[model samples]
Target chain A: MARKALIENDALIDRLSATFREVGYEGASLALLSEATGLKKASLYHRFPGGKEQMGLEVLQEAGRWLGNHVLKPLAGEGTPRERIAAMTSELDSFYQGGRQACLLNLLSSPIGEESPFKATIRQMFEAFVEALASVIAEAGCTPAVARDRAEHGVALIQGSLVLARGLGTTKPFRKTLDVLADELLADLEARA
Target chain B: MARKALIENDALIDRLSATFREVGYEGASLALLSEATGLKKASLYHRFPGGKEQMGLEVLQEAGRWLGNHVLKPLAGEGTPRERIAAMTSELDSFYQGGRQACLLNLLSSPIGEESPFKATIRQMFEAFVEALASVIAEAGCTPAVARDRAEHGVALIQGSLVLARGLGTTKPFRKTLDVLADELLADLEARA
Candidate 1:
């Protein structure tokens, strides 16, 4: 029974995340969340008695944690900077392609505007991702400042690529952009060497 | 009377464009559009009988054309490549800040999942912007392939910065990102010179 409840909870979060991606925070109403999650309003309320804001916070946190562990943690592990950067970018491309979805950060960040309760969470998530990448860059023996700047550029490129890919309605540009960025960063590192 | 009608039409388009930026294409309903423009539903229908889709298409087209002329066109004009590039970046920053809004291209692109009707228009606008930039790059004496690649990067950066800014709920980062990109390009051009 405990196992079944965990499975149900995972399913609920997944559905909620999808709804948030499809509709902005302000736009995702309780009725729509209920419909998307296949739960009755009572069940949804039971799960998130704190209501939509609670549910949104949970979804954002889950996405941030998942992405950091699966998509980013690998990049921070064993390899030369070039290999790690390549691996990281390839993972990002696959993640986007596999899901046929834009990044959750890109989607959620917009609705969280100035002073929204979710603002700090979203900012922290972004900073965490950047810091993760910077750690990997630093491991490659670059100065801390160079590593941080490169990491910032890499994060920006990934986030930006999604917007461009979505705008062009093709994933080709997105993948290509990431590849170019990876190559450029690797070249810069090699130059330092 | 004709001049007044034209003014009203322009004002309505401006309002619709603002709504689309804030809420996105799918989120902007006719009721919201009417409310945004302070137009009665009857007046909206009179101006846009084809309804929301027609208004969206017109707004998208007009924005594309206006951006091309005011932003990209200047980049393709006579000047040293570095000067032209800086001018272009400044123009883009000003244009975005002028409206205090994210680019319509970035907003509309988000909802264009497979085979969207707006796909062609969006692609065309992007291609035009890149092509204009490419011409300038090539004039700076780079190979056609190199120019095209750099131009693609430039467009990707601009579009991506807009998304980042919108997601972060601050224009400062967006504008800063663009400035960083412009500086990078300028540095590259000077090295080549």
Candidate 2:
């Protein structure tokens, strides 16, 4: 039964994540969430007693898990810096689904009226991303400061490319960004090569 | 009478823009907008017969106007490329209120469900930004393709740094981005020099 529940929760999270990604945190109304998930309000409430906040938090946690497994893990994996980053690049392209998906980090980071309850979670995710990238950059023989700066700049390029991709209504910028990313991150390494 | 109406309209747009920037399109409720603007719903409806969509559009249009006057125009102004970019950089810092303010272009670009009515306006704003910046890069003696690429990369850095700043709850990244911007934009020129 516990196993059954785990599977069920995963399914629920998938549905909820889809809704949030489409409309953003504020856009995901209870009515819309219910319609999308095919779960009555009560059922959703029974599962997520804290209502939309809980749902959003759970969805965010799931994204964090994915990031940990797919993004952070690979960056820390056994491959060289180039191999790891290239792997990360592929995962990012898939994770964002070729720039067709909106980033939950951007969408749910800020909500109207009050501070977002997810700020810490969002911060942790981005921090982890930077740290992971910085590690690889450090491994590539850049100074710690250079590693940190490059990591931050890399994340900025990614987040900014998503915004640019969506604003321009094309994926060309995103693809172009990905193409240059590995080289950009390894510039210090290649400078000595 | 016309003058009075124009003044009132600008005031209304300011209030509405503030509200939208905070909550986003989906988060901005009639009640919240009414409360923020200190106007009754009926009065708001009276001013914006097309309702929330119209209000959002007007706010976006006002932002576009500000960009043209403050950002694009300065970039195209007579000066060395570095001087013009430096001037434009100051405007950007002020416009975004030293990274404390969220960008309307990022905020209003994507709406939940049924496409943003403001996409065209948002696109034009970014396009103008790129075009203006690209022109400066070209003037700095880079090829047109290189100019366009750098302009896009520069924008991605700006947009991404804003996201980074907000996520990290510090304006350091944003400020750092500004510091490096002039050099990055004119790297080609500096290389030849």
Candidate 3:
């Protein structure tokens, strides 16, 4: 009989996810995971029976779920498109900690993760996020192609600004880009209509 | 007597840099470094006497030099501003491998590297790149303030597009962003003049 997960709760996943996001997957060893979660190695193993790989997969899924709930879903939520976009941007600002946070997707989507079992999940989240944003843009006025392109562009802007914020050690670039891009997308649409 | 340095060759540094870029600092353990560079642990320690931390600092410096020499220097080279910007953009495209390759700076600027002794070097590289880019834009016709803002914006665009390209599992977004941003920054100046 297989042992079941009793303690791989949301809090456990959050703790592990922070470790993975702060370092990359390869860096988060069993010892480090234990240190991070205040759990013994055996306890962590009991929670994540498959070890580091399983922990990574669960963390990746959690990140995707968070994005779905906080960003993608909000973008697709009902409101004036402008209001929806504004709310989504606010979620992004908070999610990224005003650009001081490193993006887990960027961290996990690298060559180190080329063979990760969860790699496809990262790509799917990105596509879904883009699709949600593009839906709002297309509904506003842009052709489907243009809206899709803009949505992808917006994703890059968010991820890259996080990189810049971390690099330049300033929240200004990330904050400004978010506000600027949001206005360009929503305000421009309002003007066009 | 302290042993004089005999190893720590540039080629070894290059190999380690690639590993770091792929998996990030915390991910590139001494064992992994040995695997990536085909060097024995003793040999790597002999080369980098201070161990992984020493190797990391050297790699960070090398990345800065490469950016300065290739990207920033080209942007400030002698030519019409438009010509100079075009050449720099081409260099950026190649350096990033059509956005397929991960950025070493982004890899190092993560939370994992927050305590890295070389963090300031990363900031310096970004500032230098922005200054080089701003100089060209200012020469083209924009006010100094406008040029600087645009240069920062361009940097964010480049970095963000890389994140997007990697996430979307395609180069089209990266390439399109490069072309579109380049046109906005460069070609428009000529049209206005």
Model 2 lDDT tens row, A92-119: 9988877777788888877322477898
Best DockQ among the predictions, by candidate number: 3
Fnat, model by model in order, equals: 0.42, 0.49, 0.70
Q: How accurate is candidate 2 locally (lDDT)?
A: 0.84
In order, what lDDT does every prediction score?
A: 0.72, 0.84, 0.80
Give one clash count per candidate, in the order shown: 0, 0, 0
lDDT of 2 by residue, B1-193 (tens): 4334433667889989988877778789999999988888987898899999999888998998888898888998988899999998899898776677777778776732246788888888888898899999998898999899889989988998888878877777788888889998898495544
Q: Which DockQ-derived CAPRI band holds candidate 3? A: medium
- Model 3 Cα lDDT, one tens digit per residue, A55-165: 988898988888889988888788877788888889888877787777778877766237667678888988998899899988888789988988877888778777877
Q: What TM-score would every model get versus the actual structure?
A: 0.83, 0.92, 0.88
Off by over 4 Å in 3: A1-8, A186-188, B1-10, B186-192
TM-score of chain B of 2: 0.91
Pick by lDDT: 2 or 3, better one: 2
Q: What is the lDDT of residue B113 in candidate 3?
A: 40
RMSD value for candidate 2? 2.7
